[model samples]
Target: MTGSTRILVTGHNGYIGSVMVPLLQCAGYEVVGLDTGYFRGCTLGASTTSVPAISKDLRAIEPSDLAGIEAVIHLAALSNDPIGNLNPNWTREINAEGTVRLAEMAKAAGVRRFLFSSSCIMYGMSEASVVDETAPLAPQTEYARSKVVAEEALRAMADDRFSPVYCRNGTVYGFSPRMRFDTVLNNFMGSAFTTGRVEVHSDGTPWRPVVHVEDVARYFRLMLEAPRGDVHNEAFNMGVDSLNLQVREIAEIAAEAVPGAQLVLMPQPGADQRTYRADFTKFSRTFPNFEFRWTARKGAQDLYQALCSIALRHEDFTDKRFTRLRWLNHLLETRALDDNLHWQIEQQNVA
Candidate 1:
């Protein structure tokens, strides 16, 4: 975990991974990235800091891919619910089965540390005020179910030598090189900045424990450096308890960040009403010294400054590259990626 240990980060070209890889490198880790390059062109203001990478789909990861890698931070997946709803089987195959396969390969390759980038959305819609790590997983969507299934699979694979830690993160929001406007807070900020209006589609009452991307990266590093006994087969809600906010509060903050932005609540039926307030006491207890650097309002301001600096346009906010579902559909419709989400070999030749 120290002395410049080599680590492989899956989904390195992704929203969180784009920020995390460079952060790990700066923190003195020898980092390599593994991604299918699906979102390679999904750049916002600048490109992600490049690293030694393998451009192969996670489902197709071979034993050779684990060679010389001491640890694996698995982040590659279908990502969100809408994307999972597009095709449930794809989410199952790539997120659930693919994760098990990668973990097995890592274990066989003598990789001691396996950090699974899990989600708090696995807790699902709960009438309860707050749910902790031990709460029953009620995954309403295929995407959330995939994470729960993957975590269960990993729990069975843990042993003395192999430590699999699940960092169940909240809905993450913050600026990255590959900015995404899909998550609630990010979407609000983008809408506010580009159009001077933040729209809340589902009554704006759903509770979401939002976390900053930089804080997420910092906590992942803490997990990477922690002793095996401390993190082995453990799941921690990866944020502070205080960061939890209602959707309306997030939108209000987003609107406040932009000078003339307005907030609108347009409750619609069939909208995503899944809500959960994560209890992060375990995270605080585990890493007592680790401090969260950004609050939701501060993060909104940071995102606003970044968006304004780039002159983010209405067209930019609606671009296919930043939205996971739209970009995947574009790939499918244009025959860039196959139905299984792998790139067509002949497409490059045609181009």
Candidate 2:
């Protein structure tokens, strides 16, 4: 893939996608977006970049949608554990089944490179001190299981002609047009910025590998343009070793970013204890020159500034549009989307 290559980025209207699309466009790729538009009006500040987009569901993707596309960056999904827990079958059908369906069509359409945006959460409650690409996957949630299942199915579809590369990402955080405050760092930052308080429900001992959203986009572009032999059918843990921070440390960073902010930790029963420290040795060795630009402190500060610019209120911080599960539930309650997560009204392609 090169500047001249035509790439289809699914979930272009999403949190990472909203940021990634503009970066990709500026880098000179001919980009086309395909999204179900669940977060169509979920912009936090300004709207996302407008590109040629297929406003259709992942399950409803057609062969014609793949025409002239040389590569595919698969990102569309239910996107989080809460949303997955809301309906496990929806996650399976969209994240797992919808992915395989897209890959099958992309392969049939002569699309060569398929970059699956996977998550490191698939290494559920990892017993390993440092989970790498080769670590045994122990998915503990519907969302994690969906990613595992999707990666396995994609691996089976990999061939000489259709190369499938999995970029398993850490907890991504930063400001974007389609902003999400549900992520760890972003959530903390939002709470601190809006209410001048950062709350941690867990024991704050769980390890989480965090990465900035811009670096994620840059790394994806690198993977897209790298030599096919270097990334073919490969899985790379997409972050640096230094990014592995504990929940308490992250909370401290967020609180420190906001002046006069308070930090509170209230450990309760069944609080999220999923912990994973990702080893990015493979990604580091593969892309030796590539550097992770933003640290957690830097990202938290950046988000703090962005939130201040918007004058984010308590209501905005708690807005359903910024949380995937709550937003989908809103759609369902308002009859904008059905129980199966499909749009109830007609959708038109955006250019």
lDDT by residue (tens digit), candidate 2, 172-232 = 9999999998999999999998888899999999999999999999999999999999999
TM-score of each: 0.97, 0.98
TM-score, predicted candidate 2 vs. hidden true structure: 0.98
Tell me the tens digit of each residue's lDDT in model 1 across 1-351. 874999999999899999999889998999989988777878899667979999888989899999999999999988999999999999999999999999999999999999999999999998788999999899999999999999999999999889999999998999888888898899999898888899888888889999999998988999999988889999999988889999889999999988999999899999777789999899888889998999998888888888878889999999988898998898888888888888885433422
Instruction: State the local distance difference test value for candidate 1.
Output: 0.91
lDDT of 2 at 349: 26
lDDT of 2 at 267: 93
| Off by more than 4 A, model 2 | 346-351
For candidate 1, the TM-score is 0.97
Candidate 2, lDDT over the whole model: 0.93
